[model samples]
Target: MRTVFVQIGEIMTRTPVLVAGAGLSGLSTAVFLGMHGTPALVVERHESTSTHPKARGQQTHTMEALRLVGLEDAFVAASPKSRGFALRIAASASGPVFHEILHDTFVPMGHLSPAASADASQEAAERLLLGRARELGADVRFSTELVSFEQDSDGVTAVLRDLRTGEESTVEAEYLVGADGHRSPVRTALGIGTHGSGSIAHNVLWGIRADLGHVVGEEQVLYYLQNPELSGGTGVLVSTDDADRFVVGVGFDPDTQHLDDFTPERAVEQIRIATGVPDLEVEILDRAPVETGMYVADRFSSGRAHLVGDAAHTMPPQGGMGGNTAILDGFYLAWKLAAVLRGEAGPGLLDSHDAERRPVGEWIATNQYRNAMVRTGARYDGPPPVEDPATLFFGYRHNGAVVSEPGDEHELLEDPNAPTGRPGSRAPHVVLDSPDGPLSTIELFGREFVVLTGSEEWERAAKSVAADLGVRLTAHRIGDGLTGPWAEPYGVSDDGAVLVRPDRFIAWRSPGPGPATDLERALRSVLAR
Candidate 1:
């Protein structure tokens, strides 16, 4: 059938930032731009919210980004707290054995919370973000399709079709962001080619509501079932949100099996066999089959158009990096766009978005492939697990960007036993006494650049620099006994300082007083001062 067209009459005087797609990535970009006083128009082909929870989990970094957009409390309220991830290995004689537990001690939420609470946090966060976006007046047009676009020096003009009304219209915007999914039409229209492999295998994901308390002992469980081929086995077990509900993910060769082969009966049998719980009762809520694949765009930006999230990079879901990476992309791009629009920075600030983020996407893609290999019992052929020092949490670097020092080498500091504040890593999460009560160091994040220092002089210097550069800088004093939980993780005593970017990554840090030149240089680099 020929696609219907929806016309937006009369071009808006304000150069609306046009966004194609209303998925998490598109919604997030629209929200941030709208909050920053920029007008945004987002078009989604889907008629409504996705019934399938394509991305069910959000990483800690995702949480930080949501918090930055003032939606953390809401997100926490919606979803349950995911404290830990457990892997279960299916055995032949013994049947199954609990393998490993990756404690959620990374940051913000930490490992103290239970699985149900974590889930609640996830739900709350999503609701808050969507609601806030609406409140901010983002023009979220659902059931709208982007037919095509033409760009010039002035702006980009896009033709969008309304699926319901069968009308077409044009939208002109100074910038166009393609927050569309992996099969992004904008990327296709831009002639962007993806570099990576397609799904190595097909997997079915289903959510079940059952009182599986007897079968699964933990609040959060991930089972790795053994198949006859010695490839990856089926994945089954309880999710972090609903205690009585479970999510089962199973791998199958789509070339051999048809969709009918993944029926609820077959899925149930697979779950029972994988978990070694023959009598377990599960009520299926929803099911979806997905083909796993990984890919990164050859380029993320072309002129006024840029890609984020799945459009920029599509990774296997093994590491749960998809949503987190997308959110980070939004925050990273938001400030740069703001800087350029407000005349605080030059267009060069936009170049760093791709340079800094592409490496991150590469890292996530590599880790995701590794996780997938581990799941599929493949050769484990992905990049070596980032050395302890470069664990997914802290190992990410901005390279020669804002705060990177020349000749600074990255060392492996993955010491679960080591103190916090290690070099080339995320500053440890700390708790400090706030006027209301105790607050997390993560709470101080978001909005603008934050300089966490111990001395008033340092705080004063930071404020001065911020004023000189026409940027917002928040300085927090790390008082004695004030470090709370963050001291050990951050490796900071009372004498150190940390410069956190708007995106929550550590820009520059020092054990004690140092020349402000580095901080200035880093900010200049990022802001294009």
Candidate 2:
């Protein structure tokens, strides 16, 4: 409902937000910004969306975020329905399975949230996001690059070049988002430093056409082939959305061999050996070398410029967290930037981006790097224990944009199953019966700040505060038109209240009805007003 479509100007250039790189993060930032009534100008150096089935699998947390922009159905329909994912230690798809590291089922998480997890490929996901972003009035241009940008207290001035015409233009924006890839020119211009394990391995990614469904099964498959006969001692094979298409990553030492050394013929032979099937018909569609590494930027924002996705953090794609995290980074920034641009929040609210996302990014990068090392037999201190998937998915907490109770210890993560509804935590999902139909409480956020209460007085206070502050805010009574058992899950009583941010994170909570000034104070603090 917060979606506000502005008329597209023929020669328009200025925007409130200028997003660089049309990857998942940049596109998502543009899409979410539009949803919050602040469409962005998105530019990408590449000519078009990626054709490669690069990253796959959208976790529950990501699905929830995508649902905010009504992308859940499209994404779920685009991907394959899977019982879950399977990671096995084997020579190849056709070879004997040496060990099974993880075999998960997707059905168990049905009650945790309203959105369904998806195995959608990055290629499909990007197309959907681009379409939605444009429909919401975003001006997304391809073959355009962000040449440089300078930011002062008021706004950002950026130079952009058309890759095709080689003509350059200047644009002004209230804020700039650097969603570029790992080698980010925007980040470089910002002088942002990175810290973590650098380039762990060099791998040649090969696109192959083969009927591996019979060998790999229908579920998502991750085959870790430890065959010394391959170029490197190890190799990885993953299944894509297409039944007959697959991606094979073969590692190689840059010191001895190069990407050029792995010719089409050599690649076929290597795939044959890894599959343990001699004379297997295989056609190489494409091949490119990629370097895997672990790194996190020291800062996520600088002045009016900010970083997201690989520009902010880079980690091995062992768990597909990088792509999901990148999308989330965009989601997190969109709302805050929208609020600041609209004068609903102070500029100081933007500073919270680094405090909220950097720690979570570091944890994910470090753990994923450790996981990659173990899977590849690379040296590490030891194989660190992986946190529960649910914890990693929904349990991560935030430190910014929240007014916590005085005694709150501020744990980074909590058991989502035993959600306490503390400030900075994700709002727990609860089924609510309404005139339309049954809906999860998760469906109630994203457009504007929301206050939930069963008390009429609190609802009145919420409405008064919104008018007094001149900000977009909504109040919903639990038992009025909506009937449900939400008080327990929200950690509030019948007369208590819960404040949820636009991103659906709990910003504050009260155990019982409070003075009229209570809700106003909480909103002011959360908005950095």
Candidate 3:
């Protein structure tokens, strides 16, 4: 329910969704909303999309979300191709390579993922998302800032100010999203507090163009070079587009060593220290000071306003998961918002975002702290843990109205390497052939709730319930000449059915043929009709 109001001094506008920020999280949410036929107005205080190359690692899970909206190939295309498999960590830039901190052998990430992973710069991803969102009819406004907002039972009324013209206007939206980054003003305006190891560190990120082929001997994506002469003493070299183009990030303490200590000229000098080259010519492309930390908001939503990305959770740059997880936040919230706005689901559906993603965010933050420990060479109390990339990306679950109750903590996250179709887990990726072509079980989801069953009677019952409920439900009967017995892994009998939500997460499953009343009650309970 929304009640529109126009204040005397503010220009009035309206959009179903108002996204406050144009970063990866905000833009992706807008794009996914547009894909679902919901128009959103995206506001960014910046004049244009960011060119910074922070958080360049896009995990397969992120790519899966991008694939759902048809941006996976484009995202992968813009990534840097690895010239070699080993990531070299050395005492100095010019010394013998000491150890391979990371390797290419473990990087065949696509096999473990539904799609594949990519090393695309954050800026490149933003550019592509901006174009796609616009194409899908989102009204994206740069140089516009969401100054203030108020929400009641019906909707949100936000005051947006154009930074360039100093013009302020009011917009009424059914829902509002805050993806505005770690220093989220929207989260603050809503009186949301965050808790965690807040101040992890700080850094000055320099995107530089320099010739380091002699030092590396081959192309590599990451280099952790240690040199005592440089500011912060050690820094990570991340690959950019060209072999010569790279981003160097040096973390410093604001209290003792200042960020102002690292100037453009000083940055180049430090780059030479890391590369072991006394005098290397380096061109500075972009520079930005980022305050790195770990924190998660106490709440993800207040009234009709919700938070995603850095606004909802913040973590260090250890695993390069900050942006990737942000993309996931957008993905989880977008479909739920779309369903509610399209009148296919009730507002209770929105509650799942917090129940699901907030836990994931906390887990990610805790793991990121482990990464920081590795960087410091501090011995863990027990033993150092390996950062399992695939496990971190896909092994998470939420139990609530949208999903069947999970078994236990161990069962909650099934083996990432061998994911079974467990209730409350992401639906297993099954390649089934369709009349049009081969389709993934994932491809059959997102636009509507789907029923996967081999029994004709189950199919008939699903269709009957769908029609009666007036829900966008698709029942895919197995063994229609294009499939086989795929029920063993799902714990489903031949006549059983699995109900998947639009986001490809298992909602409910019947072990065998159930009475029509039972199926209807399950559907009604999930849909909140």
Could you say which candidate leads in TM-score?
A: 2
Candidate 2 residue runs with Cα over 4 Å from true position? 1-12, 81-84, 104-107
How good is model 1 by TM-score? 0.77
The lDDT leader among the candidates is 2
Instruction: Give TM-scores for every candidate, taking all chains together and pairing residue i with residue i.
Output: 0.77, 0.95, 0.92
- Which structure is stronger by lDDT: 1 or 2? 2
Model 2 superposed RMSD (Cα): 2.7
Model 3 ranges with Cα > 4 A deviation: 1-10, 84-88, 93-98, 109-114, 263-265, 378-386, 403-412, 433-439
lDDT of 2 by residue, 1-529 (tens): 1222333453336788889999999999999988888888899999999899888878888998898889999998998766578888887777777888778744356677878888889999999999999999899999998888898977888888999999888777888999999998999999999999888888888898987766777787888888888877789898787877888888888898878898778999898877667887998998888888988999999998999999999999876688899999989999999899888999889999999999989988888887887776666787584657787788889988899898888878888989899999999988899999998888888778999899999999999999999989999998899999999988889899999999989999998999769999999998999
Worst 10-residue lDDT window, candidate 3? 1-10
Candidate with better TM-score, 1 vs 2:
2
Scored by CA lDDT, what does every candidate get? Answer: 0.65, 0.87, 0.78
- Per-residue C-alpha lDDT of model 3 across residues 1-529, encoded as one tens digit per residue: 2333445655787888999999989998998888787888899999888777776767777887888778889987887666644566665646666666676623665444457777777889899899999999889999999999999978888999989989899899999999998999999999999999788656677878888877665655566656567566666676766778778776667788766687667887777776667788988887777776789999998889899999999887776788888887877788789878877678887876777778878888878877766664435664454477767776777565554545544343556567667667777766767787766666667667888888898888888988887777888888875585467766789789888877777888888898766677776777665
lDDT of 3: 0.78
- Lowest lDDT 10-mer window, candidate 1? 112-121
Global CA lDDT of candidate 2, please?
0.87
